[model samples]
Target chain A: MGRAILTLLWKDLRVELRTKEILTTMMVLALLILVILNVAMGQNVVTVKLAASGVLWVVFTFAATLGLSRVFLVEKERGQLSGILLAPMDRSAIFLGKMIGSTILVLLVEAVALPVFVVLFNFPLGGRVGPLLLPLFLGTVGFIAVETLFSAISAQTRLREILLPLLAFPVAMPALVGAVGATAKVLDGLPLQSAAPELQLLVAFDILFVAIGLVVFEYVVEEE
Target chain B: MVQEDRRAVEARGVKKAFGRTWALRGVDLEVRPGEYLALLGPNGSGKTTLLRILATLIRPTEGNIRIFGRDPRREGEECRRLLGFVGHDSFLYGSLSVSENLHFYARLFGLPDIPARTRQVLEALGLERRAHDLVRTLSRGLQQRVAIARALLHDPILLLLDEPFTGLDAQASRSLGELLASLRQEGRAIIMATHNLNEGLEACDRAVILLDGRVARVMEGPEIRGERLREAFLATLES
Candidate 1:
């Protein structure tokens, strides 16, 4: 099962590497959001500092959605999803592989976007990258688990692009709120304990959604 | 004592409906190991729908199907392990090279020695030379060959092909027919759905004509030869 998941992840990664389809679009959109944010709020350092966490997450959420939609679109367009479904492995492996792939792409986008965001907004990190990393990881896992599942569901529909956000945003609201709160606390140089509650919420969200996705994914991919 | 033949596919009273309209009113079919059966039907004749149900891609609105004596719905994973499906679509990732696509599927099946299995399938389909080419860069024939290679990688005992020769050139089509014949000789049960009447009759040991979601006729041996098969096919449609 693990090997099957790895194979699936490897396939998605190789396709992305060759085409740069998901990464390029996500990075460009993330940069565009940053540039727009900088223009609108960069002039006021104090205000930028206060709003930096919210703006960063806003960029991440929307850019991540753009990337997530492509996670299943390639399969549908090339008819590869049927091939994957026909394989002998447990269906949940497909969900895990896609979730992990989307998580990596979202993180890669964040890796670049974070430094650019700091420079553009002139917000102080205060050597709190350690505290920030935990929430980022948890928040991303929660975000991707739900997004990947909904992306699979929406990909089957005629209005996939429009349907994805409509289905994803509502389910992902709690995780988004948790991510925003935890990020804000960390950026303010507070102790990790200060943001423990938000981290807990993010963790619970990840567990709940990941479990739901694994159990319900087989039904979602089955043709009616 | 005579040994009973293992059944590769057995379906009874299978029916599939989309909303109010029925695609397969009732389909009863059985194929033994080593049997090569060709499905013949006009447009919207439920040929693809029945094939999809056996492949476990979709469920039948009514009735039951067993692949290798295993229920496709209840034991789909087990059934899939012994099944190979080649549809009209290539099902290959266009961005990936031929070898990469095969390797990906080999690994998904968890085949031992992925490199060797990937090379073996590529060589079998005469795709080794074009192994490094992206699938979209290949000709339609080569791409379909790649699809075939991917399907045969796991050495499935039952093969389901839907219009496997839709866009092939004459040479490619002939080669594919020979390939299916050889696989049939090896005791693999094959269910092929095609519009090419002559080729279907020539390659298959038995032929079934479906019309209006039902089996209109079944032909075998000398009955599926020469002009008789074509006449029966037309007659089934007109009647």
Candidate 2:
């Protein structure tokens, strides 16, 4: 079961990496958002970095949604989700593989987006790397979990492009709020220890969404 | 490793319902190891629904299902390991190459020698030349062939196909028929759901006709050949 999970993840990574369509689109979206924000804020260091990271995730979340929805949506369009459902692998394994793939893609896009963000906003991320890193990882992990599960179900519907956001946003709202709170604490120069509550919220959402995805994914991927 | 007295697939009083419509009502069917069964049915006759239940993708509302002596409800993964299915939809990624798709599925099956298996499947399906072309670019016949390659990649003992001849040309269909016969020769249990009773009769050792989620009739292959099958299919549809 787990081997199939790894195989699915590997296939997604290799295919997406070679194609570079989704990743490129995401990076461009991130950079475009960063430029727009920089001009709007105009060198207000306090407001720029404080707000930029949170807002950046807003852009990343939508962009990541585009990519993540494509993950299983493409499978549905081609009817490969049915093919995969027929495979001898566990459905939870399919869920984990998709979650892992989406998580890695979002993280890759953010890795570049983060540095560009520091450059645009003129923040001292080097010294704050330890503090700043925690939010990025926790926030993305939670976002991926929530988006992946909802996207799986939405992929089956006719209005999939519109449906994913409708289903995902309500569930993802709590995670987004927790992420913004945690990142704000990090940006304000609070130690990870002081930011424990928000981090706990993020972690809690991660576990919750993952559990939900694992349990319900079978229904989402069931044959038509 | 074959278990004596083991039926390949057994479903007793299987019932599947979606909303108020009953797709399968008290369907009980079985195929012993190495037996080929042809499930003939008119449109909306529950063949697809029954196939899904056997694959463990859907559970019957009231009845029990056992595959290879393991309960699909409790041991779905174990049951899955022994079966493969292909429906009307090819269920393949349109963006990936034929080789890549097969390779990926083989890897997912955790089959030994991924590259060799990919090559073997592609060669078998006559997909060698177009191995690197994306599936979106392939014609309908080619894509369906890749679907068969995918279903057979795991070397399962029990294979189910739904209307496998839907979009094939004469040459492709003949090749597929040969492949099915070979699989039968290897003692693999095969079951197929087809609107084309002629094709189903030609392909399997046993034939069944389903009318509105019920088994209308069943006959061994030799008993339902040629014009007799055509007449039966017509009479069933009219009734």
Q: Per-prediction TM-score, please? A: 0.97, 0.90
lDDT of 2 by residue, B105-167 (tens): 887777899888888878888889999999889889888899989988888889988899888
Error of 2 at A135 (Å): 0.9
Give each model's clash number: 0, 2
- Interface-residue RMSD per candidate? 0.8, 2.4
Candidate 2, residue A185: CA error in Å?
2.7
Q: What RMSD, rounded to one decimal, does every model reach?
A: 1.9, 2.7
Q: Model 2, residue B14: displacement in angstroms?
A: 2.5
Docking class of 1: high
Every model's DockQ: 0.83, 0.55
Which model scores highest in lDDT?
Answer: 1
Candidate 1 deviant stretches above 4 angstroms: B1-4
What is the DockQ score, from 0 to 1, of model 1?
Answer: 0.83
